[model samples]
Target: MKYAALTGISPSVIAELKTGKARTLELSSAHNIITLTETAPGECLFITSVNEEDLAPGDAGIMVDLLVLNISMKRVEVTSSFAFEERERMSARIKVQFRGTTIARDVEGRKWGDPTKVEIIRAACYRAG
Candidate 1:
């Protein structure tokens, strides 16, 4: 599925992709969002990611890079986010509710710190896999 790149990226990053340069966006030692493009079979962009965001005592979570594929431009168009909670020992779970390209938002509809993002992240884990 197609989704927006959630974090506001630097102009340099956008410039790199438009130039057909391959680069990786790293959030940590373990999380990476790689940018790739195809030149022959039509212009296609890929934002491949491998990330881990929720890490806490007695629980951990992992997300294999979700492939944002066959893109045509440097910027994606939909809102997306990921968050998680520990549902078991050394296990993180995102409740099976929220899914799709949505950001956790405030009651006024601001994407502040809504817990719904946890479910969205969980869904990404499963759907991407």
Candidate 2:
């Protein structure tokens, strides 16, 4: 998702972008493995996987709520349950954050699940390149 100009990204987050590696975006509670994408102020955040069918639809992908503040730099809050993890995940709101290294195109994110399927949560930013 492409974000509008004026998005605020933390300087600490910017410094890590140079590594050319996408971070493992996980929730503070479960700390489950969701996405491995390079997050930035103007970039779109995708949830690659969360384990089991919880992140089902495989590479189908999902984006968080963008809102007025660009949270690509901090932990994102997720309150929806996935297809399989409805009660465990979606029951209560959870926080999400990106970490790890740059994710490659060959990863499951680009494949595995149906790319056509998508879930748009509270995110408001545009798709990242």
Candidate 3:
């Protein structure tokens, strides 16, 4: 299994993401894996994920009910249940914070199953490059 502390993501929650094969995933609880800490007045350390399917559909990254911050730097760490290369494609949709304001984005991806499929999509942002 991949490291949760480092990746800021929970274990394979396919059961949580899938209700009955709907095109878009319904995230019941966006708390477990998503976390942020305010480092300064209008700055924070944010970490989240963007499933493989999200990239293909061009859907937004992790959903946030209230997101209003600028992403100075962003990095994605890909993890898979099996071979990561076997996946079709990878993508992430991040909102750029302007003037310290935020916008809401949907972080829904495609359906996934089996332990041998690429499942985990982790992302983190700390500082600018």
lDDT of each: 0.25, 0.30, 0.26
Query: By the TM-score metric, which is better: model 1 or model 3?
Result: 1
- In candidate 1, residue 78 scores what lDDT? 48
> What is the lDDT for 18 in model 2?
32
Q: Using lDDT as the measure, which candidate wins? A: 2
Across residues 16-124, which tens digit of lDDT does each residue of candidate 1 receive?
A: 4444333444331111122122112222222212122321122212212332233222332444476443331121111111122222211111232311112222224
State the lDDT of candidate 3 residue by residue for 1-129, as single tens digits.
111111122334323322322122222222311322211223322223433333322322232222232223334556778644422322222221211211113232123321111222334447988
**Which has the greatest TM-score?**
1
The residue ranges of model 1 lying beyond 4 angstroms of the native Cα positions read: 28-109, 114-129
Give the per-residue lDDT of model 2 (tens digit) for 1-129: 321111122335434443444433223221221222223343444443333234332233333322112222343355655533322331112233332222212222334332222333332446789
Provide the lDDT at 73 for model 3.
31
Error of 2 at 5 (Å): 22
Q: After superposition, how far is residue 60 of candidate 2 from its true place, in Å?
A: 2.5
RMSD of 3: 18.2
- Give the runs in model 3 whose Cα sits over 4 Å from its true position: 1-8, 11-35, 39-47, 50-60, 66-129
For model 1, the run of ten residues with the poorest summed lDDT = 89-98
Give the TM-score ranking, best first.
Answer: 1, 2, 3
Q: What is the C-alpha RMSD of each candidate to the true structure, in Å?
A: 19.9, 15.9, 18.2
